[model samples]
Structures are given as C-alpha cells and as structure tokens.
Target: MSRLLFILALFLNTVYSCEVCEPCECNVIRFRRRFLCTADCSDRDLTSIPGTIPSEVHVIDLSYNDLHSEDLARLKLFTGYLTDLNLSYNNITYLPAQSLSTATQLNVLNLDGNILEKVDSTSFGHLKQLHKLIGIHAKTFEENSFENLEGLNYMSIVFGSQEVSENIFSHLKLKTLHTNFKTAKRIPEKLLNFGIDTLVDIYLDVPNVESLHENTFSGLTILKSVTIQTEMMQTLPSNLFHSGVNDDRKMPVNLVTVMIDGVKSLPRNLFDKQQSLKHLALNNIEDLILPKSESQVDTLDLSGSTLYRVSADWFTGFKNLRFLNMSRTKLVEVNNDTLMPLLSLTVLDLSYNNITNLPDHSIQSSQNTIVAFNVSHNQIRNISSLNI
Candidate 1:
C-alpha cells in the first residue's frame, strides 16, 4: 500500500496542473519569497474573459483576441490583484461607462489597435491608482475623460482626429508625455496646461505643423525637456520658450533642454527668458537667427542649415556656450572674429562645409578652453597660419 501511494504522487507530479487559468498559459514568477503569476491569453479566439482565471493573477495579456468591449466587464472579479492589462489588437470599440470602476489596484493599461471613437467622462474615474497609460488612440476625449486618474504619470498616445479639444488632458499629472498630432497644423496654447506641477519631459511630433505661438509651453514649473519635430514648421515667435515664473522667484530655473527641427525662421530673443536653458539644437533650419540677447545655453547644434556666411555677432551673446556644431551647414568662410566671444567653448565642429581656409585667429579666443576642433571635409587649402 505504501508503494502504491508513492506511485500515485509521482503520477500527479508528472501531469501539469492548469486549474488556475485553464485555456491560458500561467507563469509563476518568484521574487523575494513572493509569487507573482501572469496569465497569457493572447492569440486565443476568446470572446469573453476566461472564467477560470484565478483571483491571484497579476498580469493578463489578452492581445490578438476577439473579445468585445463588453468582455472587459468581467475584470472586476480580479479587482485588487490585476496590475497590468494588455488589450492590444482586440475587437474592442466602445468602453462602457464605469466598466472598470472596481479595479482600484490596476496600474498599467494598453489599448493599442482599437478603433475607439470617443472617451466619455467617468470612464476612468475609479482608476486613481493607475500609473502608466499607453496607446489610447481616440477621436475625442470628453471633458473629464481622465477625471480621477491622479496617479497616472506616463502616457504615449496619438491624437487621430483633427478635432481634439484643447482641454483633453487638463486633468492629468503626467511626468512624461509622447504625443503625435496626426493632422493638426498648430497646437493651441492651452492644450498642454495639464501637469503644471509634475511634468518633466514632453515630445511633440507634428508632421503638419506650420507655426508655433509664444505661449505654447507657459505654465509648467518643473518641465525639463522639450523636443518638437516637424516637417512643415516655418515660423517661430520670439518668446516661444518663455519659462514659467514662480511667485517667490523672479527667474525661471527648471527648463534645461530645447530642440526644434525643420524650421525656416527663428525670431530674435527666442531664448532670452530661459535662464536655466543648457542644450539647444536647431537642426535642418532653412534660415537661422541667433538670439540678440545673452542665453545660458551650453551646447548648440546648428547642423544641416543653410548658413552661407557665419557672422561674428552671432556668438557675441553666447558667452557661456561650450559645444558648437555646424556640420553640413553650407558655410563659405568662418571669419576671424566669428568665435571670439565664445570664451567658454570646449568643442567646435565645422566639418562638411565649403570653408576654404582656417585663418590664424579664427579660434584664438577659445584656445584656453577649446579641447576638440574639427574642420574636416571642407575646402581648406591652407592650415599653415593656424597655431594648432
């Protein structure tokens, strides 16, 4: 009898048990004496939530399924245990109001490849604990679409329709945002008024934008980086980068990086207000205009521009400039006084230009601080007069 009992235990151990999440593969991950389980129901022809998913499941991958929008209502069964949900490439269209109201512990949600038309208010009101939201491509987001998502800090979305309202994101406290304006030509000033106190980085890919206003980024107090990539942008206002002013402080101090590509013209005093600005890149700009007043920019990249002759006054106000790159900018001559005011410059790149000569006093002022200088791929015929 003892030998028969041992044989039965061996048979049980050999057969895999999937009673926790039948029809889905369950993986148990052990971490610090804790067991976290994931249920992968992807690529299944599931029309609704599996009834066998255990309550302890933390992550669920329901991608490439035929689940309709109503099938998501069954998620309430695993309310507190569900942390991540990937509903990508599904047949979901409209999200019912309050469908996920009981999911208080949910953190991350992905809804890629869905043809969602509208997001009404209170749809995500109960998800106060959600952290990152990804792939929310909708035509319109109602006034309070993100009403109670107080913990949502990161988002990557595409505004598919051109009728997106200005206040669609006014309720979020995101720290990082990556948005693509599909058909919008210009971003309204108040479109990004959300996350004033917490936002750190923002990326805007506007393929059709033609111009930008001065107060496009006015309210944020702690924003650190701004990158705008466009193919049709032509004009920029002088105060485009004016930093947010604090009540107790007179000067702005948080903003540090600014990069804009594919622009035609830039107005004077463009960065005069950014006292803490450090790195600036204006690549592929057809017509470049240096700021008339002093700026604290440390790194400046003017590559792929249409500069024929670099003027001496361009670097006069850039006293704190360090790294300068003018590679691929059609330049004929870099006069002697052109870099005289860049006393703090450390690295200079003038490669791939039409320059014919590296004059003796061209970089004389930066001799003490300049460490790397490149003038390769130019029409330079004489370097005998240069000291180094």
Candidate 2:
C-alpha cells in the first residue's frame, strides 16, 4: 500500500499536475516567493485569449496576439486577480466599450503598436487605478478619453496624426509627458490650453519640426524641465521658448533646464529675453552661433560641435555664469583672455578638443575663482597659465 501511494505521487508530479497555460501557444512563468505567476501569450498567432488561463496567474501578456472582443471578454473572468494588461501590436483599430468594465483594479495599460486611430471614449474610464498609459500611433484625443484616470502620472505617446487639441492634456495628474512625433511640422499652438500646472517634465522629441513659433509653449504655468530635440532646424523664431507664468507662486521663476539637440544653427538673440533661464545645453551642431542673452545662465554646455575658436566677448553678456563645457567641439585655439570675463566660473571643461596650447592668460583669469578645471583629451604642449 505504501509503494502504491509513492507511485501515485510520482504520476501526479510527472503528468497529472496543471503546470502549463493551455488552449494557445503560450508560456507560464511561476515564482515561489516574489513574483506572481504570469501567462505569456505574446507572438502566439492567437486571434483570441486562451480559454483556460492558469488560476494562479495575476499578470497576462497578450501583446502580440490578434485579439478581438472575445479575447477581451475573457479578461472579465479573471478581473479580480489581473492588474496589468498588455495589448500592444494586436492590430486592433477599435476598443469595444465596457469590454474591461469589470477590471476596476487594472493599474497598467499598454496600447502601443495598435491601430489606435479610433477608440471609444469610455474604453479607459473603467480603469480607475490606472497610472501608467503607454500609447502609440495616436490620431486624436477626445475629452472623456482619459476622464477616469485620476491616478495617472506617467504617459508617453507616439503621434501618428497632426490633429492636436487643447483638451488633450486636460484633467490629468501627469508629472511627465513624453510626446514623440513622426514628421510633425509643429506642436499645435493650444495643445496645453487647459493650464495643467502639475506637469514638470515635458519632452518633445519631434525630429522633423521645422520651426518653433514664439507662442509654442505659451500655456505652461510651471514647467521645470524642457527638452526639444529636432532635426536640421536652422533657426527658431524669437521668444520661441518663453513660457507662461505660474500664478501659484508669487516670486519669480525660471525653468531649471533647457536642452537643444540636433539643431544646425541658432538664430541671433536665441536666448535674449528670457529672465529666469539657467542651465543651457546645446548639442550635435555642425556650426556654433552663440545666442546673445542678457539674462544669467549659470551652466552652459556647447559640446559636440564643429567650432574651432571661442572669443571672450561672446560671454560678456552672462552675469551669473559659472559652469562651461566645450568638450568634443574640435576647438583648437582660444583668443587671448578668451575666458577672462567669467569672474564667477568654478567648473570649466575643455576636454576632447584639438587645443594644442593655451593662448596667453587663457582661463588664467578664472583660476582664482575656479574650483575644478578639466582640459584632458587635448593635444596640449604649452601650458601657459595652468602650471601643473
């Protein structure tokens, strides 16, 4: 009798136990202590959700399936345990209304790589606890599309259409908005007309944007970090980056950072009128045209350019200038007293340049007020002012 019991246990362990998710080409991942079991049905050529998902599964991956209403309907059965739903790359053009209404606990939703040119407004309202929304190929946004997403904080969308609107960003609590566009000529003038002050990090990664208008970013109230990476932009119109004031704070405020990448040239007076602008980083330019700004920028980076020389008079405008970076710029020579005017400079990085020798008193005027100076990766032979 004992031998028979042992044989039965072995049979159960070998073939009788339910260890795999069935009815579809899938993989079931189980964790003993930390991870909840997950059903991965990605890239399975499945037109519908598997009929039999493991009962212990708390996460499902249907990202690459040709899912339809039937697949989504299966989710209502496991709504209690499932928190994440990945429907990316499903070739889905429309979302059936209330298909996930029972999934009130859905927290993360990824709709990337779908034909999301059309969608029902209330398709997302059922996900009250949803925080992160990753979308792709967006055509337009209706007002009620994101109405119930109160806890939403992180959102990144890839634009497939130029139909921008004011209500698109309204009534959300997003801290960061990363909008990457393909061949978008311009960001609609009133994209943020609702005055969403909670947004702090706004990244516009539209490579083909030709020009920036003076009122491009006019409605933002409290934007702290701004990054605009474009392709072959010759010049930006004046007042292109002047942002609106935040009424919540009585004191003056400037954006903590501003980064410009992949621009070929800078129009004169590019940074001229801004009051609170501080850190400025210019990258990946074939030519260098320093903008004339009377306002103070404590940190300035002119790296990865084709410039060969720098003049002292070009920096006389910055009053509170401190940090300067000219790395990887191929600057071989500096005019006499080229860096003498920066009285408050502490950190100067001239590494990765073709500089052979320092011109007389080159940056020597700043040694007393400077803290750390890096001139490594240069072809330096004469150290005129820097003794060591």
Best by lDDT: 1
Clashes of 1: 0
Q: In model 2, which regions exceed 4 Å deviation? A: 1-74, 80-99, 111-117, 139-144, 147-151, 165-167, 170-173, 243-253, 267-276, 285-298, 317-323, 341-352, 359-385
- For model 2, residues 1-388, the per-residue Cα lDDT tens digits are 9999998786454332235666533333445653454667788888987777754356677887787654576666665556777889887776667677777767777888875665446767677788888874556556567777788887887766665555676778787788887756777766744445677777788787887666656656576778878895776665565433432322113577878888887766566445778898888877667666575789999888778877667787665789999899999988766776787888989999999987766666676778888889999998775632
Model 1 C-alpha lDDT per residue in residues 315-361, reported as the tens digit of each score: 87789999999999999998888998998989999999999987889
Q: What C-alpha lDDT values do all the predictions have? A: 0.80, 0.71
User: All candidates: CA RMSD in angstroms?
Assistant: 6.6, 7.4
Error of 1 at 18 (Å): 12
Model 1 TM: 0.72
The CA-based lDDT of model 2 is what? 0.71
Per-residue error for 265 in candidate 2, Å, reads 4.0
